[model samples]
Structure formats: C-alpha cells, structure tokens
Target: MQKLIFSFLMALASLSAPLQASEPASTHANITQEVNDWLNTSLSNSPGAFSFELRPIVSRLKLDGCTQREISLPQGNRLVGNTMLRVKCIEGANWMFNLPVKISIQVQYAVAARPLAANQEISTGDIAMQQGDLATLPGSVILDPATAIGRALNSPVAAGQTLRQEQLRTAMAISQNQKVKIIFRQDGIEISNEGIAMNAAAEGQPVRVRLDKGKTITGTAQLGGIVDVGP
Candidate 1:
C-alpha cells in the first residue's frame, strides 16, 4: 500500500510540471501581439496607404509579466522605408528588444499616356496617373499631373513611362519681342511702362525687357505677358 501511494504522487507531479511551463509560452505570444498592435496604431496617420512587415523573434526570452510596453523609434529615424523599432517593457520586466520593419506605401504619380517625342509639349491628354509601390520607383517621380502638364519633354519617353521632374522643362510663358507691361512697386508707390521682351521666359522666371528709349532691364515674367521690375 505504501509503494502504490508513492507511485501515484510521482505521476501527479510530472503531469503538473508541463502545465506550469505553458504559462511562459502564452505570455510570450501576448507580448508579441501587444507589440504588433502598438506599431499599427502608431503608424496609422502616416502619409499614403502603407503595409508593414515585422520580423519574428526567434530567441526565447524569460521575461516577467509586463504591465506596460513602450514602443519608440530610433533618433533621426523616419517611418518610411526600411527601419527599426525599439520595444521596451516599461513596467514589470525591465527588458528591451529591437524589431526589424519594412514599410511600403502605395503612391500615385504621373506617367506618359502615349509615346512622346523629344521637345514635344506635354498636355493634359499626354499624361496619365499610375499607382505603384513608392519604394520601387525612382526618387524623382512627379506626383501631380498639373506639374507635368504644359511642360516640354527633353527626351523621348515610352508609353506608360513614369514622368520625372528633371525630364521636362517649363513651357515658355512670355515670347521674345512680345509687348509686355513692366510694373515697378516700391514704398507703396506703383509705376508702369510698356516694354518688349528680349527673350522667351517661363512664368515666374527672369526675362530681359527693352523699355522705351532703348533702355534694357531684367524682370520676372508674370501671367498675361506682364513683367515685374523692382525699383
């Protein structure tokens, strides 16, 4: 009878040991989920639509039950592109770990709607909008159709080619030898004169103008063939 009692007690202890070991595993899963939730909430306000990829923690950690977790980014780190996040347990266990993250955003940019020849003036019908992963495209991609419209292309672009700011030039807003109104404003006083543009220039760009009596002056080109001269 004594031997049977001892055997029964040993079996009970062995069965209960596994149950105690399972608690840490469950806590670790909860910790991982907490970290994930924190990251999603933190980046909810980022520009454009984004998706996140989190690296799994392979090493086993013996951490106590954490009452609070603090998530932070490294100094000078942006939420875009590939970055790292620091997860620290502010309450209970005093431990920290780094998580590798890859952030991808969907971006809409302008592209050539059809094959365009060199020196061709770009119009509203010449461009189209395209959506793609920003990380995979060039850094100089043009995001707005308005920016590309009315610009002259410097090189031939294939159909569906992404438009870049460097690939286009501003269309001439003022033509050479055109009659223009030259205005000068200083100390709340306004002066106006008639002048002929000496060179073609884009809007908001500098243009040389020939005023009456063969006087020449440089001024900024404005809309409606107007030039602004500083006193």
Candidate 2:
C-alpha cells in the first residue's frame, strides 16, 4: 500500500511539472498571438484599406513601461513537417496574452501634389491688390502691395499656354513731360515749333502738339511722348 501511494504521488507530480514549466512561456505566446492577429486584421479587413509594408522583424517589443520581450517557439512544441509560416508568440503576464497593436510605420507611396510651372503668368488673386479708384491714380492699374501686381507665375510663358484674364491685367499708362516739334505751313512757307511734353502716351497713340508761338497742330504718331522732328 505504501509503495502504491508513493507511485501515485510521483505520477501526479510528473504531470504537474510540465504544466508548471510551460505556464510562463504559454502566457507570453498568447500575448504575441493576440497582437499579431490585430495587425493581420487591420491589414486585411479594415475598410480604410490599409497596407502591410513588412519591415525588418523587430527582435523585441515593450508594452506600457514594461521590459521588452522576445518572441520564440514553445519549448516542447514541434511541427510534423516543414512549413513556410512560422508563428511564434511571447511569454508574458501569467496568462496566454496574445494581442496585436497598431504601430506607426513608415512607408513610401506615390501621391499627386501641385507644382508651379516655369514662366506661368500669376493671377491677381495670387497677388494682393489694393481696393481703391484706379482711375484716380496716375496709372490705370494700381497694385495694392505694388510689388505683387505684375509677377511671373512661372519663368517665361510656355509655347502652348493660353493667356488668362487672371494672369494678366492692363498695365497702367503713365504720363510724362516730352519735347515735340510743331510744324505750321501757310501758303508756301513752313514754320517749326518746339515745346515741352505735356503728358505720357501709349504705343500708336495720337496727341495734340502745342507750339510756343500759340499754335497747335493735331497729328497721329507712335505715342511715346518724346518725338523727333527735322530742323
């Protein structure tokens, strides 16, 4: 009877030994498995369409200020045949805790972004324009910032570019004093007159020329205010 009781006790201990030995490792494995599942699901099932860019396997991970743990196979666990997928879990916190967590991962992806072109004419909205009566100003177009009005959107206008109203505006024409010669012809005599410029002119413009001798002549010429005439 004594020998039989001792044998039964030994058998119980033998069974208990394996469980004790595996308890810690099994707990860790559970945690690892759980986390792995979370990641896999996010990669496959999420409606946001996530992609798994597998990075180099990190050897260890820490959770919530805890010591980092390594993932490995169970000691007595063995596979019958060779398999491509090797799933391992870490031993942690008493229970077989396997849970996956999302981590910030860096990946390379292609995206479309706007780029400024060379020689593109910039629009008025692109620049700041002052609000005031432009006619009252010396020039037709008065820029609010002054510097922003006329600027190149891109370097030079490309060959196939269509000019847009936003990209361009009528430049303010300025007036300046100029000297012009006034000629008077009476019968067979010709008289020449010279005077200071009164105002600025535009290209292909016509202006009235006033002579010093109280005479005025109306003529059309390329307007630049400054004109050349013979002696």
| Model 1 TM-score on a 0 to 1 scale | 0.64
Error of 2 at 118 (Å): 16
Candidate 2 local lDDT, 149-214, one digit each (tens): 344442334432333334443322323446765445556677765665455444335555666776
What is candidate 1's lDDT per residue for 93-205, written digit by digit as tens?
A: 67888878887888898898999999788999999998887777787888878988789888999999999999999877788999999999999999999999999998999
Clashes of each: 0, 23
Candidates in order have lDDT scores of 0.84, 0.40
* Residue 155 lDDT in candidate 1: 96
- The reply for model 1, stretches above 4 Å from the true place, is 1-27, 46-49, 62-67, 75-82, 90-94, 116-121, 150-156, 165-172, 175-179, 183-194, 198-201
Candidate maximizing lDDT? 1
Q: Pick the candidate with the highest TM-score.
A: 1
lDDT accuracy of residue 221 in candidate 2: 36
Q: How many residue pairs clash in model 2?
A: 23
Reference-based TM-score of each model? 0.64, 0.22
